[model samples]
Each structure stands twice: as C-alpha cells, then as structure tokens.
Target: MDHDHDFEWRPGETLEVDGEAARTEASWFREVLGRYASGVTVVTTMTGTASGESPIGMTCQSFTSVSLDPPLVAFLPTRQSRAYAAIRRSGTFCVNLLAADQADVSDRMAGPSDDKFAGLAWHPAPGTGAPILDGVVGYVDCTVEAIHEAGDHVIVVGRVVDLATGEDTKPLVYHRGDYTTTG
Candidate 1:
C-alpha cells in the first residue's frame, strides 16, 4: 500500500484493506500499547462570544509537556473531531488535567454530545479564555504554536501562556480501557 495518501479507520467500521496485514497490525498495536498508563485531560477552546458560539472540547489521553524555557505542551486530537476544528479556528486552548473524581466529565467530553459542557461548572482560563473545568487537578492555557499530521490524529503544539494547579487531588488515569487513580 502507498504511504503517500491518507488513511482513516473509524470505530465499528471496517476498512477495505488490500489484505488483513494492516488491520491485524492495528489491532495488535492498540492492544499492546493499552497497558501503558496515562493521565487524562480535556482539551478545550472557545471560538467566540457570539450568540451561537459555545466552548468546545474533547477528552484526550495523548497530552504531554514538550518544553520548558519557551514553555510548550502538546495534545493529539483525532483529525475528524469537531472539537479540534474549533480549537484550530480559535487558535488557543486550555488543557484541563482531570482529577480522579472527574471521570464523568471525561466520559462526557469523550462522547458525541453536541454540548459537552452541559451541567458542568467551569470558568475561563485567564490567558486564553478557554474553559477550565471546575474540578480539574490543573490546567495549562496556551496559544497554538504548531500543528502536524499524524496517522489518524493531528499533533497540536501550544505555547503555554498561563497555568495553575487546581484542587489538590489525585490525577485521573486511564489504563487498559479502565479509569484508575494513583495512591
């Protein structure tokens, strides 16, 4: 298969691959890597204060700190995520590190709901004005620095403008398809 073109695989949908090699490899790769534990975050952005505009966000496990001096952070959002499209348009975002008690928030953001912020208490991060969820363990407010394409996701690098620790609580973690917290 040619690697020049793009490929996409959606959940519950089958791809018409030339052979099972690609499919099998994808499944095996996911299974093997699922064992590595990671903290969860909700990457959020607000496009505008217009009548119909609302905060957009998605729960992400692929978030990490990328630099310190010129402070940078990165998060991977699927290419097809509407939330990501909003983030790109806004050119700024907030990464809310979830607290262990906020699993419901994670599930809500991860779903296909049109309004993920419904019934959730949150305030805007001062730097970017993106929603900083109320019970998050911490948050990083940033402006988009760069974007790159990955397999099914796009890597977003943000230049940190502001940050702060929120409630003193254990971080929400995901591992092997389950939610857990550290001691």
Candidate 2:
C-alpha cells in the first residue's frame, strides 16, 4: 500500500510501536482554543419536569450561525450536562446572546443549582416557542434538526424559527476560562 507521511516524525514508527503514545492532546487543544475569543450564549428549552414548567436555560460559549437562506445555527453541549438532556428531549430551544452586563446572569445559570431561572425576566419567543431573555444582546429560536455525536460533546443543528436583536447590544466574550466584554 502507498502512503504519505509528510508530517510523521518517523514514517515507519507505527509498525515498531507497542505502548501508548505519551501526549497531552486534549490539554493542548484547550490551551490553544483559550487564545481565541467567542461570544457567550444561553441555550434555553422547556424542562418536562413536575414543577411549573418553565424554560430551562444554560450559559454557554459554544454557539454560532450556520446558514442564511433556511436560517440555521449550531452549538455544542457537553454530553453529561442535564440541560443538554432536557433540551434534546424537548426538541426545541432558544439561543440568547448575552450582553456585557449579563455576566451575573450567565454565571448563575451555568451553575449546578436547581433554581437558575428564578427571578430572571424572560418572554417566550414566537414560532418555535423558546423563552427569550431580556437585557441580552440578541436571540434566536430554533427547532432541532439533527444532533451529531462528537467526542465528549454533541453538535446540535437547529433550524431557526425566529430572531431579534436588542437596541443596546454588547457581546459577552469568553477566553481562557475568563469572561470578557466588548470595549
């Protein structure tokens, strides 16, 4: 068989190797990605619990626009998160881009606490039906189209149903495990 091993340190090393390779690929990736800036978002869905049935939302930095014509967006949620499970079951959600001053809200929602939504003012978005948070940068409601399993996270693809941008929008940023704001 023919092969190209341009990037390989030792082209035929694999044939002679017997033990596990010592490397920190995951940590390296995390460190590299920390240098890049990303906007913060809240992915919200209705929790099918016994309580009053309010929208369940979580603060996330993994969200982005996918398409324009059909209107799409994508986000990755950690596979182990309870919020991810509920959102997956509901099959609908909202992506709320946070404003600069909304860091407190984001921090609160990202915790493991049970009552994250309490005292937070929210209004239901029309069409696909996801709650939109006030004092945020913008919002987009979506219906789950496909959820592809990635390594430790699941890539959620959603078809956008509605969208709205606030008048005073300031993007909240995340970098190196720290929150930032657009200056």
Candidate 3:
C-alpha cells in the first residue's frame, strides 16, 4: 500500500478545526496551551575551550524525544535566545531535565543574567562537554543534527551522543504559568 499522498494538501487550502480558524490569536493560543503541563529542562552548551570557554544555558520546556533507532531528540528555542545563539555556534547541547527540587536552578537559567551558571553545581558531559547540571532528573547530550524554522522558535533536532538518568527524583513541571511537580 503506497501512502505517499496520505497527507498531501493542495496549496492555498486552509486547515480548519471544527469550523474555527486554524490561525488563532497569539494570546489565545498561549492561553489555551498554558493548561497543558510540561516538563522543564535547562539546555546547556559550551563555547570555546580551555581558558576562554564559557557555559551557556536557558530554561526550556519544549523538549521531547524524536526517535529511537538512531537516537534523536528535539527542543524548540526562541530565535532571540542568547544561549541558543551560542548553542548554534557550538553545534552541541545537553538537555538537563530538572528535578522537582531544582526550581531555583530553573529560575536562574531562565533569567537574563550574564552568568546563569553562577553557584550552580555541574560537570561537563563527557561526550559533548555541555554542562550536566547536578541534581537533574536526567540529561541528554547531543550534537546538533538539524535545525528548522518554526515561527518565532527553531526546531532543533539533536543526534544523541550520550545520555543518562540521575538519582530517582520527581521532575520539575510547568503548568498554567506556575511551577509544579509529579507526585
């Protein structure tokens, strides 16, 4: 059974959901999606090496596993993120899945501070050299596989190079604009 055209749609054809416009107002979109809970992560990377090397990181909730056969993962980062710019330059990143008790760490990485890593305990991921933040639930170290434009964010596909889980811990979560955690 050839499924080549299973999802094909003609140009100029609009997609509708229950007669509602597929393109909703940005505020409404965000408001509705806010109801969904998501796990938190700090995406980290290193730029340069030795003496001048610096760590870059930003709190992210848009992360997911994309594949298993070849080991791939993805995260969406805003185009204007300074840390993302450095990650793009370095061509590698580590996604540190925040533990429930790491809300402070998340706040630190999410801010506009010049040094997000200040006072943070972490070590370099052996495969990518990206920071593996201490106390995280888990981490995924990867080399950038591909980047695709997605509205104001970029869909970054990373080929997993190394990954591991930390001590069993509940994950940090975000829902309706507040921090939460699994039971």
Best by lDDT: 1
Candidate 2 lDDT, tens digit per residue, 22-100?
2344445557888888898888988766665767777777788888978889988877677788889888999999898
Give the count of colliding residue pairs in each prediction.
0, 0, 0
Candidate 3 similarity to native, TM-score = 0.84
* Residue pairs that clash (backbone atoms under 3 angstroms), model 1: none
* Residue-level lDDT for 115 in candidate 1: 74
**What's the CA RMSD for each of the models?**
4.1, 9.4, 10.0
TM-score, cand. 1: 0.87
Candidate 1, residue 174: how far the Cα is off, in Å? 0.4
* TM-score for each predicted model, relative to the true structure: 0.87, 0.83, 0.84
Give the number of the best model, judged by TM-score.
Answer: 1
Backbone clashes in candidate 2 total: 0
- Candidate 1 vs candidate 3: the lDDT winner is 1
In candidate 3, which residue pairs get closer than 3 Å at backbone N, Cα or C atoms, i.e. clash?
none
lDDT of each: 0.84, 0.76, 0.83
Order of all candidates by TM-score, from best down to worst? 1, 3, 2
